[model samples]
Target chain A: MDKYILGKYVPLNTFIHRLDPRMKILSMILLMVAIFMPFPSWTFTFVMSGFNALIIFVLMLISKVRLRDIIIQLRSIWFLLLVLMIINIFLPPNGSIHIIAQSGNFKLYAESFMQTGKVMLRLIEMFGVAMILTATTSPQELTFGFGWFIKPLKKIKFPVEEVSMTVSIALRFIPTLIEETNRIYKAQSSRGVDFKHGNLKMKFKGLIALIIPLFVSAFTMSDDLAFALEARGYNPKAERTSYRVLKWSTKDTIWIILITLFAAGIITISAMHLDLLRHFFPKIW
Target chain B: MQIEFKNLYFNYNNNSEFKVTVLKNINYLINKNNITAIVGKTGSGKSTLTELINYFLKPTSGQVITDGFISENSTKLKFKVVNKLRKKIGYLFQFSENQLFEDTVIKDVSFGVKNFYPKDDGYEQKSKEALRLVGLDESFDSRSPFDLSGGEKKRVAIAGVIAYKPDLLILDEPTAGLDAQGKKEIMDLFKKIHETGVQIILITHDMNVVLEYADEMIVLDNGSIQKYGSPKEILKENVEKYNLETPHIYKTINALKEKGIVLNNVTDIPSLVTELKKHG
Candidate 1:
């Protein structure tokens, strides 16, 4: 149950952990935009992904986030990766300029590898970007960061603060719900729910037994949490004051400058079709 | 059942960066025929120890032996043995009312009985008897447990547990979150069940309940047992030093002693009053 690391925050005082939450959010967006930059050439896409992966790798090292945790989070997208590979293998999207393997009418194309690798790497890059943001920044910081970003929307009656609070509260509930599910599973299993060896019908019965009670508990907990929020003076559509006044430091300005330049470099390189690896290794390309 | 813990150590997540040892190395053999109370502050691994006994949790090291059945970290316990062990010991978890899911109270109460005795035709009768013992009447049998009050739902959940007639009952904060009246009723219900030859081991924060009901007490602090003895014997010691406030009756006794009126064995109000009357 603890294996998941998608929205879980690890409390470690590191360089990445110390960065302003707003800066982290901004950096993640810049990197994601760079990874998905408009580059039609397969080689360029792969090169861009490599750069994004390198950035993510550095973040992981600095944040001391474990690879195993990231890989476990990445497992969710493995099936889509597999499906992309399977589809691309039979029907190459990049063109069958170089035939890698052929059996009867079935043929493997080198270009298929290009397309699959491009997509697979981008998926991993994006997942890594999100993971880095969530793992380093606690939900409270993330909520405040998000609110900082959307503060302008409050002028248009967007309920910006409420949205941020809802998002952070939802993120917080993920682990609580997981723990609740585990407890319910243990409680039911002890009552002889035979989930392991039960037949299909028996398993269905066991699932119903679990689901109803879990819903009840979840609802009960949500009510309690709502009451707690109310007791703490959380009101929707009310003028709220900031509890944590986190101001951006010089470090945040430096991060912004670096990320803007990186974004510009990605756009320039993609527009110029300057994929140096493909340019040097013509035959390999 | 002869329960023994042999140097048991438990971590919720072992072999991980987030590893936290919940139970430390300790060994104790529970005297089989006592109403044992395991009391500790929150996060002191009180619930973990009870879970270990029920085989719901496997220790990270050493072994937990209940009766002749043994659960070890390195080995897989057979389902037959696990099922047998679980049936012989009914566990009433904290917020047990949340475990209720049946459409009606009777079916919910009979859940455990049905599980352990699917072949027995008298499971419904057993459920009714259990409900009666918990002070819920026949009208409650048809009502949805979820529709009932919180205290009633708890009673229904407890009834489900005792319907199976386990050799031992393990309660984790059975009376927690209840009103004084509700707490008294539930504790008295356990006493009635205990008289039926079922040994009870409860994890509770209620020192008064421990003094009034428990025959043996284990004081756990930071995953280690600091004292193991009868309630009177252990509660007489410096309990506050172990992250526990002294029970109110004990505080009263001490205050009277300071006023030159020392009382012995006066751990409860009734006993203190009786002792005071006798002294006069």
Candidate 2:
């Protein structure tokens, strides 16, 4: 199994890894908001691109993780990229006069192509930022961040700690579960169950043989885990002291300020519709 | 019934880069109604040997020929044949927790029986009888299997298999991670079950259990049979040869042997105790 594809966060003492998960999560949300807020003639796009490049460079240098490794993680979604491109080329645009090309009965419009490029770039940027956050943060840190983020919901008696623990365990076991699924799949295949050779219906039914054993193993593991947890007297409601404190230092503050400013700059540029920037920039459309 | 493995070889993941050869060119026989103990160092193909007998794994080469069915020669094992074999051959997993999947203890025990005999009116009755045989009360039938203690869970797992009335019972490390009392209870339960004419095969690392209960023992090393003989003969002669420890009672016998205190019929604790009293 490709470890990176399953979000198995490689531990390293990199700058991105050092930043608090709460800050990383907040930055991810701000970046997504900036992407969707619209840009003025792709100038904001260049600014965001430079920002993403800076983060990626710092992460790669600090974490000592290869750039090729991150690319491998992104490769799983190559089909999604192709689908987005196809949808963009065929989608009808409102008030579009220019036809880029015609194939068979389909007319490719200019505006739709431009929109598709913007959407694809946005998708890449969003997921790229998300990958950085998840790959750098440990499951414990993420769970703690969840608890801190959802502190306001405590007034409603929401089981925030319990939910965070559940999320953490689920994230921790995803790789294990995937490995188990692969084992079971291989076992069934050895039994002369040709999963790949069958028609759609046959393939679907063949999946049953795999699913039943996987589910059986999962339920059994859950039972053992529950027993282990109970034996340790794990109380979700107990007040606990954390080993790692999430504190905001000068470097952390600077990182947050820079990210916030870049987000604000994108929004401001988009809202103002600055014509000088538009004229100077290349037409990404 | 006899199961003979002739030059059987098995690898868990045969095609992958990380393939592990668990059992290698193994040849052995499990005779009918005999209590055979399979002993080996960790990962010495003990569990794999038992799994091969029930066709849980297909041998890479050679054949495993049981009385009525021949697994190695068969092209594919049908569900009917597998289910039929399973009904007569019960396998108790090392971690008994994996064996209990139903809501309550009784339901978990009855799962195998219900699956094998869905329409039988005596299914529940048989489940209760199996539980009682394992020294579990009828009231435990409604208790959640998850809520039971480790020893209780093991008993329930045993009851689950016994409810199917299997002729051959194979246990994988049945006394693992249990207290002395828990271990004694489990060994006693095995004795009771064996007395009912079920052939028993125990895979274990504990030498004490082998001395106490097993009639025949086989030592496995690196996927091959190191030695196979009766417990007393294996312990008295070849245990140290395989770099295996003899049981404490046998160790005492060895100490007495150095002092020229020869005693006959000193295999078990009771006989040893009687011999010591005579010497005094």
Candidate 3:
């Protein structure tokens, strides 16, 4: 089983990896808000791009995660890019003659191209920031951060400990579940169940045979887990203590402040519609 | 409970062209309250035989009867009876980590017990006692099982089965990758558990464990029973014929025999050590 999917936290002593997870999570949200702020002018997009590029460059240096590795994670969302591009081609135009028609009415429209480019860029920025956040934060740190963030909800009688426990278990089992599914697939295939040699409907029905056993095994595992938990004398009502504490340092505060300022600037510029900001922006190509 | 397989023959996916005939005409009787070690190389139907005892795989022909209940040849017996029979037998996997899925060690260990005895009143207490038996402290109950070491994880898995309090315990390679200290701890735990009167059937290739713990040993070869007798008798007579190596003590005795050093039977390490003292 490859342990890479649960963020693969390499535990480097770099600045970004050492940053408090709570601040890093807050910064991630801020980055997303900055990227999505509505803007008719292209300047905000250029500024957002510059900010994202700086983040990627700094994160790569701190985490030492190869650009190729991050790009591999992006490949999973390729279908979303295709869908956005198709939607862009049919979207209503804004009186711009951006379409270039070539022989026999085959045309490439500027509005569609620009819309697709903007959507793709935004998607990449959102996912890239998320990937960076996860790569730098260990599973324990992320769970503790979640627990800390939700601590205040205890006043409202929320089950924060239970919620965090569930989240941590889910995170831990994601790789295990993937391995189980692969094993079940191979086991069935070995017993003369060909998963790929059938028509659409036949293949769909065949998948049930695979899925049923997997579900059965998962239920068995869950039942076992419940028993193990009870045997360990776990009390859901008792207050839980963590082994690792989430400490917010000076560097974390600086990171949070910088991200907040960057987000505020983007929102303020978009609101004001400044002419100087509009001229320096690059047109969507 | 006595487990007996009479002329059992099994082939997986029998109707297909790629069918694998795993076992054929196997005959064996595992006596109750005694440790039986099944030794075989890979693909010798050892796993298949154990699986048959649990009814995980039914024989194509012949019968697997255990504790006066027919487990595999259930055409004559009802399904409910077979289920009742299986509830008495606990099967431990080779890779113990794969069986652990609970968030905490206690919960993972109590999984089998909860399944078998759902209506029991003191389930929680039983679970705690099982964990204690496995040498895990109470402080570890609430901790995430993912944080546990490999040997600890294996112990937790064993604790799960132990909590069920089954009549028969079947373990497949329980000490595969443990260090010397870990192996001793686990083997001693097994010995303590066995002394409490539960029948233990272990499948292993470790001759040292077989010599130390097993009363009877069965050697499997190419889906057939190659040898079956008391461990001492088999080790004394035909250790070389079966291509199975004896323990170091047995090899030393044999070496001494070639050198005209006459000694009474030295079957185990301790006995050999005592005999060497006589010469000194």
Q: How much lDDT does candidate 3 score? A: 0.74
For all the predictions, what are the DockQ values?
A: 0.61, 0.07, 0.03
lDDT tens digits by residue: candidate 2, B1-280 = 6889898888775764447888777888777678899998888888788877776778887888866777774458876676677778877766655445567888767766765675787878999999999999978999988788878887887888788788888888899999998899889989989999999999988888898899999888888888888887888774765657789888888889899998778987899999989988
lDDT of 3 by residue, A88-145 (tens): 6766346546666545655667666666677777776776677778878887788888
For residues A1-285, what per-residue lDDT tens digits would candidate 1 score against the true structure?
A: 655667678888888898899999988888888888757566566666777789778878888877777778667778888888899988887446789888999888998877777777777777777888888999889888988989999789898877887897887887788877777777777777776675898778788888899899889889999999889987687876877887889988998899889888887877886666667788987
Task: Encode model 2's per-residue lDDT on A31-86: one tens digit a residue.
Answer: 77776775444445556555655665564566554556556755877787778767
Model 1: CA > 4 A from native:
A37-48, A110-114, A194-197, A221-235, A278-285, B16-18, B76-81, B115-122, B245-256, B259-280
State the TM-score of candidate 1 restricted to chain B.
Answer: 0.96
Q: Candidate 3 lDDT, tens digit per residue, B1-280?
A: 8888999998876754447888889988876588989888778888788877765567888998878767554465443454566568767767655555556777666655554565776767877897898899999898876677889888877887777677888888999999989988998998888998889989987788888889888988878898897888777765655556777777778789899886786877778878889978
Candidate 1 chain A TM-score vs. reference chain A: 0.87
- Superposed model 2: Cα runs more than 4 Å off: A1-285, B238-243, B258-264, B277-280
Enumerate residue pairs that collide in model 3: A98-A110, A227-B107, A228-B106, A228-B107, A228-B108, A229-B107, A232-B106
> What's model 3's lDDT at B179?
94
- State what share of the real interface contacts each candidate retains: 0.48, 0.02, 0.00
Ten-residue stretch with the least lDDT total in model 3 chain A: A185-194
